[model samples]
Target chain A: MSSPAEYAPTARTVPTRSRERAAYDAETVHAILDDGYLCHLGFVADGLPVVLPTLYARVGGTLYLHGSTGSRPLRTASDGGLPVCVTATRVDGLVLARSGMHHSINYRSVVAHGTAHRVHDPEERRLALDALVDAVVPGRSADCRPADAKESAQTAVLRLDLAEVSAKVRTGGVNDEPEDADLPHWAGVVPVTTSVGEPVPDPGLAPGTPLPDYLRRFVGA
Target chain B: MSSPAEYAPTARTVPTRSRERAAYDAETVHAILDDGYLCHLGFVADGLPVVLPTLYARVGGTLYLHGSTGSRPLRTASDGGLPVCVTATRVDGLVLARSGMHHSINYRSVVAHGTAHRVHDPEERRLALDALVDAVVPGRSADCRPADAKESAQTAVLRLDLAEVSAKVRTGGVNDEPEDADLPHWAGVVPVTTSVGEPVPDPGLAPGTPLPDYLRRFVGA
Candidate 1:
């Protein structure tokens, strides 16, 4: 029996190495997934694997991927569902250790294994498009012009359920072996975070329009 | 005959959508790959695609990936070269437009399609290991204790040639339609950059040891 709050471990979700770092709890998975807008979507093409970086949004138990109608993965998915793996990582710090072999990265990542299906239903596609816009900026979907029928037809929205998901997170400072602790090396962690710079307005933006409130809020966050 | 300065694009290297964003020049690909230490490596496993985020280093035309001997990818490569895809992306900014469908991320990404092979030569393996350490912090390889024989044997180094590679980059501001320019929504770009926090020294550092000069240089970079 599996608990509602935690994803049940399957053969694919379990890590063969670093077993301690894998987290199947919903909190960890959702937190890692929501932190980034970019994901590397992987799928097999002609018996060879291909990975492409693209934008994605997560709503409830589903992950929505944004891509073009002509994209190979999207076209394959539209015909029927295609097996896909989505991975997103948030690098928190660089952990410098006393030995080159011990150096590691402090990061939180989510890897989802499932089949990706194109969202054909009109209402779900509409909502998924909005979610993709908001994924980049909070409340951004409402501020933008809605897609017309022609525009909607050109875009492809892929949906993958978040059932087989796992997150692996590494934190804290260097983990030098006891014997190597006194080495001359300067060992520690350099924390990393995403910093937003001053927003650059479009050259033809309306003359007096102010920066949106949500953007300011995003900057503050 | 192909130019020496640029990689010749194959059928898979070309983009089906937004063809203008693709570049096959060596300069563009190297710049994007050097800016980040993490990469998503994709390979087919059990006839399904698997994408795992891992640390990588580039040396000339070869990219080195570090992993444990027990790792599936490394094990498979050790037996015989396996088809693989490696992708690294650097998010430059968020491009907000007047329409939801037009919003796009300002990013530079390199997607390489190739096969991965395990490093068996001792001298090459040693050099690749040093490159991997320096990839995280420049000049870091010399600062740390060198890996001993046992440690070296336990670590697996996978090499992938950067031949079939393409870099896609999007920069500058939003591309809102001329007709939608007057929409009240604010359209602009929020520049994104990696910010490094103060270095946190390890709890077990020697009493009089000072922070290394290389780490300071990394912070400035």
Candidate 2:
């Protein structure tokens, strides 16, 4: 793996000492982001740190995030072009073992550092906002309504450039000790996976509207 | 809401004009941590930043995290007593709408700041290690064989004091425009929940060995 240990932001702000796993190159970082659906954003509020989990999408070298204009963080960031750190992660599987100490999970994740700038231009905001929509359901954006003036006014969109980012991943099976390997304890990966179930039709859908193929083919993250 | 808009970390992290959500006291902070099962750990590596999702458990004012000794991040941090930033999040529901632009998700999250220290004492290491095990599945440690010296040596434990932490959350109904609210568009929370299904017994388990209550009652995060 191409580790970018030297490029990660290391301030008192970030305290993890696992330098090697704490940072990675753009390729690794983008791969993790492409596979995940959500991100947790970190920023300062009143001198303390606040983390918020929100829907996000990656476009080229930047991440776009948005929420209600009424949201405190979004409202504030949108108004002042505040800097916010965002992170995305996906849990792949669960490792079960004969010993509690050896049990673990397999996962992939990305963390990025940058300032969030509000997207105010009509066209850019429209496009940026659609990234979020597309992220959850790729082709659904074209099928849905574009934000009208009033709706656009009520939403806040912030853009964070992916200038600095990294990814850390762990995979594979149990690592039982030589002596314990034959101790009659069942040890293996339980393989936890996310799968989408049958979609519930909208109670108010017009009589003959069929389910969208994109939605029907949906698979859980 | 005691919005401490002038906190230190917040001042450093948040741009001058960003609106940070309310500052949380220990009570509120701990509540979010206790309620959520997973955390996104942020750290800088190779000059870039990365985030990873992992299970976490909080006891009093401290958070305990563990991973394989071979894991690069854990190994590097254990070697230098480096501090790491950890975050946890929970999604309450998915807000679907008549229009994609108005759709959103409801969520809660917590972020903690601390310098992770490697647990060297055998007894504390064992206990701290078990805390992680129990966090994933209560009573799992007792049900399984204890980690032998070799197995214990293959794992690494990091301790983080949950002193500087904060939580930002958003919840409610969709923000549909007045014009679109009654446009015959179905709007409401679809209600996404994480729930555990039936457990599959290990193939080699003794024929009549009943499933442990913890494993059987497991709730997905």
Candidate 3:
């Protein structure tokens, strides 16, 4: 059973057996999506599944994939809409147990299954590109030069609505068997984290171009 | 044209365009695969692509997916050989440029397209499970209780040959336009790093179970 804020389970979105770790709430799905940096995009081609890693941004309920106009997925999305499954995963920790069978990783992942289409509307495309830039570094779009007409034409933005989405998360600690409780093996969870280091300036930076506040905060400089 | 020690590029395996940063060398492919912890496994289901994040380990030229027998992908693979595409990506940094069109992420990703079949051989399945546990925390398989017959029967594994594989890598700094080089915007890369924090022991642990040497080294304790 799903809560009011959760997306109703469909035939495909339901968690197979361990429904405890899976959630379909909007808050859960959005949190996982926002915490992610890259997403693996999957689509069928020639009757075979093809998956590629790409950058994406979520604005409200829609996911925008930014790429060059010549890229295969972007091209395919432009030819009407393309069916896709986009997944974002963040590893939290390594769960160690007394038994190998109980070992697992603590992670938060969201999967969105839907159809993606190229954003042909000029206004939407421009905003999507800005959103993508901002996603890379928060508040980055304000400092950068907006894409001119030519650059806009050379880029493509694919839009996928977050309609059928579910998140599966593994949190807390090890689940060792009661029979193996007396084993000598140490069991626990080692936390994993992602942090941004110092910014690496381009070789050809303008003299006295101050680092933006957003960049400084992002890198904790 | 692929060099020796590289898998021959098929129509589907070839990089779509700008193959300069894409590689097929076994060394490159294997290195990227080994560095990754989880992979987004994709397969066609209900005439559409379905991608799920799962634990995987590589042994030579084969990738083994470890999961419950009740899972959808594992069940489908056991039906027959399932056409699958597995992709692993590691984000290195955020590349911020002076123009929105030039912004991108520095990442290393490997995509493998092949058919995955259930590992029916008992010995192979045992080794595969061991490899998976070791992949999570190196040397962990030796420390934990090996999966017994009942545990092995409950778990399922899918093996996919690394026959069609390609690796795409993006490195270095921002690629800003010469015209926008003098822009006031500060452009560079923010390095993203993954690190392990202190370990938290399980509540039901045997008193003073020493941490394994590998675990100590892994967590830099």
Candidate 4:
């Protein structure tokens, strides 16, 4: 018998035994979520599973997802809460190879398993929307106009509690087999990274308008 | 009552009635999967959930996943098949904001729900590995040295059948609310994209080795 917490509604997808490397604690989960601005949300739709890549923000222990009211998924949740799985991941490096089979990638990722409820409370939705903006670019919210009643009415916000979530990571140099390690093959992390280049100002911007300093302060991936 | 096909072992993440925009057909799923080189895989581990971003290749209806044999999840799967969820996403543009909350990203993504079985059959594993390499760089695999027995032993390959899957997408210009549309805020897609810069040749390569056409044929994202 499975514990109540482990009682998967549909059992086949749940693992029976835990793998040491696959497990992660709360702190690690929070760290990955904090660093990522976008998340891939997985959910069952109709009889099929769908993934949506969208902007999100972490507030306290929950993730807030926002989208247009015209979007089917968001509208469905607006009328009532729904279950959603969200995963946030970042690629840290590329594993180069001596052989095709040995090639791999280095990455860090977080998965949240829970239900997401529509944020019916107008105030909470407003704050969550702000958080979403800030998550993409710091100090960006203040520079832009606030959402008015009609605009807010046209959007939908859903909150997924990250009560049961985990983070997993794999990094470092390529793990070439010992025998092949001695072979003269170039094997190491190629170091794939994402960096914000100098911001391109809008063509119509006033000549004196300066880019925000926060945009320059990038976090190490 | 649901159709037998819909009797999947996962809960509906979005309201069944509102999944129209969130659900995609098989062709859309394969298209999204085929176009991307990396993916975000999510799975439950140790009562928690996690996501890992890694490189992948889609072959027919199966996805070939590569990682070190020592990787926790891969290792566990090598010893025994494990249930896992995988997703691949591509970003097409960034929605810039007049306000932070309105800023968003436009993307396409595919999610799969299935168990991953380690490839024990050497020949099949080799093909899977080759497909992965070829997926990254079309002609590079043949140019690279083949993996020997020892090297193959240290690498892990898992195949996930793309049975339960769907792709969702959002694209086009920013949909600013009417009131905010008139606000003195610059709102439009920044049109972010990924493209291959000129390939820097390896310093130690033979002086006469011409860059392959495959490497030069990269189209913008």
Residues A1-221, model 3: lDDT tens digits: 12246666687888786789889998999889888758999999878899988789999888998777877778889888999999999999999999999998999999989999999999898888888887778899998899899989988889998888899999988888889988888899999999898888898886667778888887787
> Residues B12-100, candidate 4, lDDT per residue (tens digit)?
33424235545545566777888767886655545344455556888877888877776667876866676777878777666765555
lDDT of each: 0.90, 0.64, 0.87, 0.64
Q: How does candidate 2 fare on TM-score?
A: 0.69
Per-residue alpha-carbon lDDT of candidate 3 for residues B1-221, written as tens digits (9 for 90 to 100): 12248877888777766588888999999999999669999999989999988899999898999879888888888887889999998889888888887888888888999889999899999899999998888888999999999999989999988888988899999888788988888888888988989989998876686778999998888
Model 3: pairs clashing at backbone N, Cα or C within 3 Å: none
State residue B190's C-alpha deviation in candidate 1, in Å: 0.6
DockQ for all models: 0.88, 0.20, 0.84, 0.18
Q: Which wins on lDDT, candidate 2 or candidate 3?
A: 3
> Model 2, B52-104: lDDT tens per residue?
56567776677877666765568767777655678787666556566876676
TM-scores of the first chain across all predictions? 0.96, 0.84, 0.94, 0.85
lDDT: which candidate is best? 1
**Which regions in candidate 4 have their CA more than 4 angstroms from the true location?**
A1-26, A70-81, A97-101, A200-208, A213-221, B1-35, B41-54, B59-86, B99-102, B108-124, B137-140, B143-221
Cα displacement (angstroms), candidate 1, residue B87, comes to 0.5
Q: Candidate 1 at B79: error in angstroms?
A: 1.4
Q: Against the true structure, what is model 4's DockQ?
A: 0.18
Isolated chain B TM-score per model: 0.96, 0.81, 0.95, 0.86
Model 1 lDDT tens row, B1-221: 12236888999999997899999998999889999889999999989999999899999888999899988989999887979999999998999888887898899999989999999999999999999999888899998998999999999999998889999999878887788978878888899999888888888886666767887888873
Candidate 3, superposed: residue stretches over 4 Å from native: A1-4, B1-4
Docking class of 3: high
